[model samples]
Target: MTIQTVTTTPYNDQKPGTSGLRKSVKHFKKPDYLQTFVQAIFNTVQGIEGSTLILGGDGRYFNREAIQIILRMAAAAGFGRVILGQSGILSTPAASHLIRQYQAIGGIILSASHNAGGPEGDFGIKFNISNGGPAPEQLTEAIYEASKGIHSYQIAPIQPIPLDKLGTYELHGMPIEIIDSVTDYMALMESLFDFDKIAALLQADHFKMRFDAMHAVTGPYAHRILEERLGAPKGTVMHGQPLANFGGGHPDPNQAHAKELMALLFARKSEFDFGAASDGDGDRNMILGKQFFVTPSDSLAVLAANATLIPGYRNGIAGIARSMPTSQAPDRVAIKLGLPYFETPTGWKFFGNLLDAGRITLCGEESFGTSSSHVREKDGLWAVLFWLNLLAEKQDSVENIVRKHWAEYGRNYYSRHDYEEIDLKAANELIAALLDKLPSLTGQTFGALTVGSADNFAYTDPVDGSVSQNQGIRILFTDGSRIIFRLSGTGTQGATLRVYLEKYEADTNKHDQDVQEALADLLTIAEQVAQIQAFTGREAADVIT
Candidate 1:
């Protein structure tokens, strides 16, 4: 192995956002922009002159181009080997699994998650640590600092490796192995789920299910798992293609983006018993029942309550966790199980330490992300498989099972309304104005609604004890209801204001109301509590999730 350095000018906007360095393709095409960031990643990590690294992407636009650049840089940086997925396309969860399977030093994933993709749209490059999770804060900070003052980046003028072939090649004396993209991942799913049982359920016509892939990375995975493995009809999976532009759709599995699936569910009504979809990169999931939408909050609780039915969770759940802005349903389950319950700041990395420390077996976010000890990251396909296995074991309809759960333990009604792509300045003004009035809002009383408490949420990691300030703001009512406001960290441009509403109702009579109707009053209060109109200068939200 040889070490070298080459001088280059630094580019602005190299700072990574919530996940990674995201920008338009033109931005990444600037002089030495990608090289500088790649070099900074290499420079930040130590003892990687000849270590194995993993490389792959979500097959978005610029994926192949970025892979070539990264290959050249990795060879120049003296990496021993690179394990890449065939066709240079690996869903986010697949890449995480490959990183852990190969025991690579780290992995580079090219994706902007559910964001739009094209030459003119968003592009991203995220680094996952050796533990198969997103790079920790310390490592990300180091990479950012290196990017700031970078004067040069190293690269070899070598021929680009052919990523489409499933074979081994040599690039500057470094081994590049392209493996079957879905084989190992499918095998892992098999180990975690009982395919034979699910097959029996499908063959017996116990339930009718529909799975939408949204034309993103999970298309193949869904086809294999739902159709081939589970013995469902080939047409059971919809939108089964890996389109760079995600078929001109948002590729998010939520109700707003997956309206087609939602309509199909409602049109057929009782025909389909279960419906589910995964977002781009396959890290987020939305689970729906026939004519019933299971909020992410309720989804996590249901999964936790029935975890033992799945072989992977048979040892009993180690613990449970949820993002701070998510409803507190899992906390109640954790209490019942006598296990730890963690409330961490948003982002999947916050749960990494707890997962590594064995403090939690299951964790989820309100943004339709759910996972357990099966993997470090939230896996959309995995969550769907969990629901399938649960359904197979219980032999009941999704709605009936959920209704029974509510009957036994009560119901926690929750909803998150997202105002997407608003002006940054306006969003910040709204948050600032709300913070200024927090003191006054703490003790005020309005009709039947009385403020019980209020404050900005600040988190201190239990395992590492790292503190994250100004996460979000919350206002609790005296009647066991609350409203939370925060700007979404995953958006590509403009701010996304997320307003979460939670109210606990132990009465079964009122549990059957529509969610939007149930939260109608709180939605109004949330708009007023945050002064959304006065701050953002917009009367209506762009989207509600």
Candidate 2:
């Protein structure tokens, strides 16, 4: 095999956000686009020669092609071995685990998580460090800098390697192993969760659960774990197949995207006792009961409070952490448990340090992401299994568990409104205007709510001491209500302005109120302060969750 160094030019728009470089598939298909970015990674990250690397994706369109390109690049870049997932399928969390379990140098994951997929849809790529976490800010920045000035990329000139079989193959003298995507991940999950207990709950005649993989990467994992291993009925896992275009449905595990699952769970006298869904890359999860929805925040809080019931956490957890935009319900749990708690920025990478240092046992984000020290990235199936173990041990309905939790720890009414695909300039202007007004907004009163403080969110990593600034703008009210504003880069076109509204209700009587209705005052105040409609011409949020 001959190693070739192809000349290339830098693409100016290659900077990655917290989720990595996501863009339209057409953009990535540009000549030398993907090659340039992959080469930038190999060039920037040191110690590539003769090191092991992991590679796979969610089996979306172009996933196979991307894997082929990266494999060839890795062989030419002097990697000794590459662990490739069968049929180019690997969920985000599973990839993280593979990186750590194998002690590889790092891994390159191809996914535009929760985004639409297809030739016309989105595509993305991100490098995870040896710690099995998203490359931290410093490394990502370095990759971006390298992408800007790269003039050539190295690749092994070879035919594509077959990825359907679970066996080893040679690619330009480097050993490439096509491994079963679910076995290692399943083993890890079984270790942390009481699968036997969960299996009983799943097999019980009185209880029925539905897990929607949304035709994304979690289908096989769910099938292998829930049906084949745990003995759930055959049809328990819906959309349990990895499709290139996600079966023409948006694969986000949210109320808006997982419509079929939500409809089934919300139906009158719902057939299923519990319902769960995972996103495209299987890192985010949405949990529901019979006509009951569990917010990601509440899910974290409930799980943390009852973690000792699970086999893995029987000895108790080290601590708890949540994203700054996440509700404070889990923080309250941490306080009650007398465990350390941390509030970091939105990315799961922020939790990596704490998890690595053993400062936090569990961490979550309001974006339907939750995970523990078991993996660096959020694990959707793991969250589902955690809930399953909790349900099996408690021998109670999901609604009761959450209601009881609310009664004990109080309820945090929270909602996030997203104005997606809006004019980029307008969204930037809106956030810029808010940043300028943050200083004066303090002590101001708006519609019976008095602002106690306001500022752009920032954080200093306790473990690494690295600083991340301008995370988001937040307004805190004296009544324990808050409205946060941030620009999301997960979209392919335009900008997505996300406004998070939260209010703490200690009165148990108000716990039954509808989430949007409970936060109505905060909603009005958020719009009044941000002037979202005026700035972006959005009458209402494109999606609310």
Candidate 3:
């Protein structure tokens, strides 16, 4: 088994974002594109030689090809073993779990994560460290720097091994194990949640829930957990099959992308009692009740408030954490529970240190991400099951649970407006102008709302003491209303500007109003603060969630 070193030129644009290196499939198809990045990751990671690496993907287009190439590279790079998922399928959260469960040195995941798939769509590669979390900023920066200067990559001269097999084999002196992707993940979920209790809830004749996989990676996960194990009806999991192109639909689980589920759940009278959807890699979730949409911010608060009801968190949570852009609803819950809470930047990697240090047990983001200390990455199905566990234990409707929460701690009328595919420089200029005026605009007024404070968000890691500045620009009103603006780091095209609007309403009666109507004043104020329309040339937000 001879190793071959193929000389190649470097690509300057292989820098990683909040998660990993993402680009269009065509861009990745360029000569030595994926190879160069893989080599860079191999060269940058600390003490990878003779280590085990778990490898898989989200079942997107070119996933199998990429898996084969990575296996060959791992063999030549002197890895002791490579654990590949059957059919090259492993959702993001599952990969994290496997990396921890097997005690592997690290892992590689191929996914674009809620982006479209296929030849024309997006593809991504994320590297996780020994702790089973996304690589930290310093490590990602090292990978990017190595990518810029890489000249060659090594690969074993061997034919592709069959990924469908279920046993271990030897390839180029490296042990390759292909295992069922769903089995271990299902087992992990069963341990964290009350399987017997959830089964009883699903068996109830009046209880009905819809789990929409969006034809992405969560399809098999949902089918196994919700239908087979829980004894729900066979048809409970909709779109419950992984497709390379995600059935030509965007895999994001939002009102805009998951129109069918949202429409059914938002109807005047929905047949189902609960509905849920997950993103492409199964890390992000959208939860809905009949005629109700629970904002992700509110969902985190509800989970924190009811943590003691579930088996896994019965003893109570240590603390909580949320991204800066996420609403302050969780803060209220944390205050009531007398638990410490930390606000980090927009990336999940920021929560790794907190979780590992045992400073926090639950962490989430406004981008439909929620998870506990179960694994480093967010788990979509886990959130859904947690919601189900709460619903069953209380014997209450989702709407009533949310209303009760609001009655206790007040409601946060929250919405995120996304401006997609706009000019990058124009968006930056808008931000630059905001930064220039942030200090002077504190006392100014936007309509009846008086600005109390404003600043660019920053964070000092409590565990490591590292500081991250310029996270986002946020303006707070006197009455606890907020408007936040930030450019997205995950898009494949032009800049994507996300405007987050939030208004705290203490009156429970006011919670029944439409979302846009509830935040109308903040919406207008956000545009006025950022000059969104004038700079981006767009009238309405592409997606509001």
Candidate 4:
């Protein structure tokens, strides 16, 4: 094989957002676009030679093509070994586990993470460090700086390597080990969960579960673990096949995107005991029971409350952490357990340092991200199994479990309203006006609530002592209500303004009210405070979750 450096110019828009460098597939298809970003990653790491590089993706449209390019580049970059996933399929969580399990120097995960996918849809790539977590803000900034001044990229002149075969293959003298995508991840789950108890529950005649993989990367994982190993009846897992286009639908597991499984669970007198769905990369999960939709915040609370009942958590957890915008339910649980609780800024990357230092055993976010110390990235299937393990041990209905939790810990009525595709200038202006007023609003009143504290969010990493400022703007009311405002960092088009609303209710009877109605007061105050409709010229939020 001959190594060659190809000349290319830098693209100013290659900077990564909340997750990674995501753009329209057409944008990535521009001359040397993907190569440019990959080369930037190479330059930032600066130690690719003699290091093991793991590569895989969510089996999206450009997955295999990207893998081939990266493989040739890795060879030319002088990596000693490259671990490949069979058929170029590996969920985000699986890739994280592989990075740590194999002690690979780092990894390249090709995923847009819940974004729509196709030739006309979104595409993305993020590099994770050896700790099996997304690159921290420092590294991400370094990559962005590198992407700006790149002049050339290196690659080996070599033939294409077969991606579907499971064996060792040589490409440009670099050994590529193509392995099963599900086995190692499943092994990690087996160690943490009581498989025998879950198997017995699934074997019961009356217990029924519907797992929607959404035609993405979790198909094989859910099928093998839920059906083959746990004795679930055939066809319990829906969309159990990985499709490049995700079967022509956006593979997000939200109610609007994953309507098939949601319909079955919402149907009158639905017989299914539980229903769960995972996003394109299999890291975000939405869980439902009968007609009940469990919000991500409540789901984390229930899991923490019932930790000891699940075999994996039999030994108990140390502490808990959650994104600042997340509900205060976990704090209630942590308080009950007398464990330390932390609230950090948005993004799963913030939880990695805490999880590693053993300061927190479980961490979650309002964006349907939940996981423990078992893996750096959130695991959708892992959360599902943890719920199942609790259910199997408790022998209670999902409704009962949630009602019981609220009865003990009170309920946090939480909702996030997102204004999508707003003009970038207008959105930034809205936030700027709010930031300017944050200091004066300390004692101001909105509707009958007095402001206790109002400021933009910031955090200092406890383990690494790194600081991140200006994360989001938040207002706390004297009545224990909260309203948060921030622009989302995960979209490709115009800005997405997210307004999070929450109010705590300790009365059990109050928990029965509609979530929107229960939060109506806070919602109104938030709009009044931000003049949302006035600034964005929108009557209502684009999406409420």
* Local distance difference test values of all predictions, in order: 0.85, 0.94, 0.93, 0.90
* Model 4 worst lDDT window (10 residues): 249-258
After superposing all C-alphas onto the true structure, candidate 2 shows an RMSD in angstroms of 0.7
In every candidate, how many clashes are there? Answer: 1, 0, 0, 0
Ranking by TM-score: 2, 3, 4, 1
- The model with the greater lDDT, 3 or 4, is 3
Writing each residue's lDDT as its tens digit, candidate 3 over 152-189 gives 99999867899988989888989999999999999998
Could you give me the TM-score of model 1 versus the true structure?
Answer: 0.96
Q: Once all C-alphas are superposed, what RMSD does model 4 give against the true structure?
A: 1.1
**Shift in Å, residue 394, candidate 4:** 0.6
Rank the candidate models, highest lDDT first. 2, 3, 4, 1
Itemize residue pairs with steric clashes in candidate 3: none
How does candidate 4 fare on TM-score? Answer: 0.98
Give the poorly placed runs of model 3, Cα more than 4 Å off: none
User: Clashing pairs in model 2?
Assistant: none
Model 3's alpha-carbon lDDT is 0.93
Candidate 2 ranges beyond 4 A from true positions: none
Measured by TM-score, the strongest candidate is: 2
